[model samples]
Target: MPKRNTGRRHSVSADQIQKYLQEWFDLDNKAKYNKRFKRYLNYRDILTILFDRFPDLKTAYELKEKYIFFNRNTSLEEAEKGLAGLILEFGDSGIEEYHEFYNLLINWNKEIINSFTIINSRRINNSFIESRNNQIERLIYNAYGYTNSKRAKNRIMYCLNKKDSYTM
Candidate 1:
């Protein structure tokens, strides 16, 4: 889907579609559908309405959800098989946008599969590093422009390294 809302054309924005699908996935267990809504029934109704109005949106959402499911639940051994199935589904989806995502997965297939590894019951992933990078990027942006790389690095390290005051 396009980035803009495109209200008159009955097209949803990228953000809106992301919200809907993210709620549908409920990976974090903190999704709106889990807390505010009574059950899947309500979200199902909303999705039904959207799907009826824009069939392609439904296809795209389902296609994305399948990958989310596969990524979260599939074992390392099953990763290749599951990804192959997803690749076929993407090809069949007939939505051109999915091809780019499929290509990304293909390019990173080895790393993606390796990420399924678990150590001490924890999944091996780069979430912490990614979040830190995002925070540092935000700090840089808020500064309007950092002229000195060393100063920016020091500021980010200071912010990141400070101990939390809250007691557990």
Candidate 2:
């Protein structure tokens, strides 16, 4: 008889069940897939947190804030200590990709770390800033009822060049 090779087995965890249950009960998630759409956050990490069945939104938010600090705020070496513990908490959970990311983070050479911590630290996400400009234009449209392009340009210039605005 020829030897047969079976593929890897897949088993769902209790954490998975708890998460789905929480998702089932979440009114915000039911009303709209809120966190599913945000671009600034890592959806996978958020989903990982969702699986743990938090007691309240406040606690969930604290986890999310920690995630943001870990993933985005790369300014301080001290800030990364928590990320190591978080990655280990999911030990052998079959998430090889997450493990790989953790490895990459931990194994990064000093130059690369310094570059991200300092050079890239000045970069802020532009989506919100651009949207705010559009919001100001819309406000001009609504507040002054300026339906013409000339008025829109003047309003934008006024808003952008005002002494109160940092651009000035």
Candidate 3:
């Protein structure tokens, strides 16, 4: 019988967890699904829609200038707050669907703000997390076949261990 490794223990800041969750959300099939067409939104269409809806506004442009001038050192909270304000200002419709969408956008903005706070204060680098993700993908490819639950557990263990051993 092959012995199962219990896996390494590691600590991750809440920001890192939130970032991972956000990436998972972005990659999820359900999130990409377009109910209207019964199809998934491809990357190009997603970018187009986002750009159309949130076109370059004067305030956002100014923020970008400030960010660039300051060498991209703006606080995440400030950036998120500005984004939430812009979305609320431009997308606010009294209609139910639009209202729900706006609220969801605001919630995401808040999540980003919180995540940035945790990440900036932490002692971890994002490259470590990304490398762990790559490792998990390789493992999945190598395994060929495994229960979904088992794969998920293995991926999580790999991420934790990678984060623990990585320094940056």
Whole-model Cα lDDT of every candidate shown, in order: 0.78, 0.55, 0.57
Candidate 3 matches the true fold with a TM-score of 0.32
lDDT of 2 by residue, 2-41 (tens): 6543423479899998999887755444233455545333
Q: Which candidate is the best by lDDT?
A: 1
Q: Write down the worst ten-residue block by lDDT for model 1.
A: 27-36
The deviation in Å at residue 18 for candidate 3 is: 26
Model 2 has an lDDT value of 0.55
- In candidate 1, residue 60 scores what lDDT? 97
Q: What is the lDDT of residue 28 in candidate 3?
A: 30
Q: How far in Å is the alpha carbon of 20 misplaced in model 1?
A: 12
What are the per-residue Cα lDDT tens digits for candidate 3 across 20-75? 88876563334467887587786556656666676554335444454354324546
Candidates by lDDT, descending order? 1, 3, 2
Better of 1 and 2 by TM-score: 1
Best candidate (score: TM-score) = 1
